[model samples]
Target: MDLKSSTVLITGGSSGIGLEIAKQLLEKGAKVIVTGRDRAKLDEAKAKHPKLEVIQSDVADSKQVETLKQAITSKYPETNIVINNAGIMRKINMHENRALEDVTREIEINLMGPVRMTQAFLPHLKTKPEAAIVNVSSGLAFVPFAISPVYSATKAGLHSFTQALRIQLKGTNVRAIELAPPGTDTPLFTGDEFTKEDTAGPKPMPVDELARAFVRGLERDVEEIRPGVSNGLKWLSRIAPDFAVNMLGKSAQNMRH
Candidate 1:
């Protein structure tokens, strides 16, 4: 888990947390490749960090996922770290009429995207002397956020998948690490999803702080890295599940009105 010598590929790396992680990793001397669907954003990221290898691909697309795997693995044989960080979030009112496909978009990108990428890149990762797969989940995975029902569900499933993946990869060179982050000061929240009430609470962890914690976890070869309040959410989910849900539901109630 020495990131200094690892070549890493991070999906959704054009903005927010992913971009921050890539920048930090690059500073640590890791070869970093960043992928996103937006050509402009990818270009912007490349402009910011000249060392970044940019790939324009969407994890939600099976064909593109395969193409990315083939391209990166062949191009950077030293690639031993894959960070499945690509995802999207939306506020949907289930009571309102919506297409089934639209309703399930979060599940497709947030949950299935990682599943696809891991399946595609795992064999290549295993061949290395030491490798790591980091799946970024959310604190909401432990406590469902009623406003972002679909988004929360996907992260929950991803948390479960990471647990099982670790067990399956036991005694192997490839280490499965799950990074469950609490509400962070990222574009993912400050964009369309934020409400007055959502922003009224305590400030979230800064992106750089989260990135630093991630590198610390990587250096320690940790199995799970929960930053900021995410650790509290995990404990609350286990000891007081109903209370945690109710507390989260209160925040969602604001969005409902």
Candidate 2:
């Protein structure tokens, strides 16, 4: 709740939405540490924001998660917030012959990464006076994006996990918060995998705005922060699930043709 006093660790903070959040949190006077798999990107992020403490750690690897927990607990024991924002999205044509390991890559990082990170650091967080675990899911979680099936499923899974986690930690110091962001103008969204036609609907929310929403939600103690179209997606899914699916499935139709 008190951003100025809290020390936050964000996974995949090198760029995109994660980097924006790190920047905003730093501006708010929060001690921020960011992790990413790429050393060069981490260095670049550090160069841009001298205040950010960057660590090269891949969230997909269980071993790396354990090492990260040890490193953080030893060096920055005051870390009371963990933001699981590390994720990858790919446009996979499932009809093509792909390796089994390749198809499920998003699951490891987007879903299981948070699960492991929470299990590893929850005890440490619980010992603190106050703490929070912010899981960055997506609007796709509310309604499946057929174009990026694996990525969509992972976010959906994360949404479910965060809800259960919030209930389990009902009387604890740590709060489970789910940040379901809509399509954002990030490298991840505009990457090589997605073409212009694939994301031709509403303009993606700016990454900085999403980060601001995250801070505001945290300050207000909002358990679920759905910014921009994400809020609409959730309600639409409830009101007209089939229509929501058909609307999003248009991209898949384009891919098929």
Candidate 3:
């Protein structure tokens, strides 16, 4: 879909990929609204990009998402695009003793958040002649990461849900797209456990490059946009599923402290 002159809402737009996408959309002359849970970070992002409309809302909170939906629809009824980019990833040892609620946090934020947001915005999006829903998944969705099993599972679930949503939306004005990104240079991977030595090989693609790839994919109407190593993971999973899973398992084992 043409991005220029369109209104777009991006969750988790305070930093990383979401922020990059917001910047690009603004440059493209689109009305951009960004949401983040942290008020300070949202303010910082707004300060950096004066054109950005920042909203403080936690995707994991149902009430907050409902409020966000009502606020956005009331203020920008013409909003035609929703980017489900809010998510959290944590490296956890399943064998370790941890609170049950703590262990499933990724599932709630990464998986359920998009589902909730989509349900809240689908009707509004359908009202527009042209609309899109971009769900940000991960390469780990194709192959499990043993160190972050919960995170991987959540991404996999998201991928599945996006596929189903796309099919269900057939013949509708709304379009569903999934962006599966490879390992990237973001704060999410800044922990000591994710040192350079832990990476399988070369460094990840630049965040800016990945964001550009996303826009290109969307413009081309690609259903799944797998940038960088993500494409390799998808192919490898098909050609050698067991081997790919084993490889990731080995990498996680080495990284575990």
Q: What are the root-mean-square deviations of the candidates from the true structure over C-alphas?
A: 1.3, 1.0, 1.5
lDDT of all predictions: 0.91, 0.95, 0.90
Task: Report clash pairs, candidate 1.
Answer: none
lDDT of 2 by residue, 1-257 (tens): 99999999999999999999999999999999999999999999999999999999998899999999999999999999999999999987776788998899999999999999999999999999989999999999999989899999999999999999999999999999999999998999977879998888989998999999999999899999999999999999999999999999898885542
With candidate 2 superimposed using the best TM-score fit, by how many Å does residue 190's alpha carbon deviate from the native? 1.5
- Specify the highest-TM-score model's number: 2
Ranking by TM-score: 2, 1, 3
Candidate 3 stretches with Cα past 4 Å from truth are 191-193, 254-257
Q: What lDDT is reached at residue 152 by model 2?
A: 96
Model 2: worst 10 consecutive residues (lDDT sum) = 248-257
For each candidate in turn, the TM-score is 0.97, 0.98, 0.96
lDDT of 3 by residue, 146-220 (tens): 878899999999999999999999999899999999987777765465655556665777889999999889888
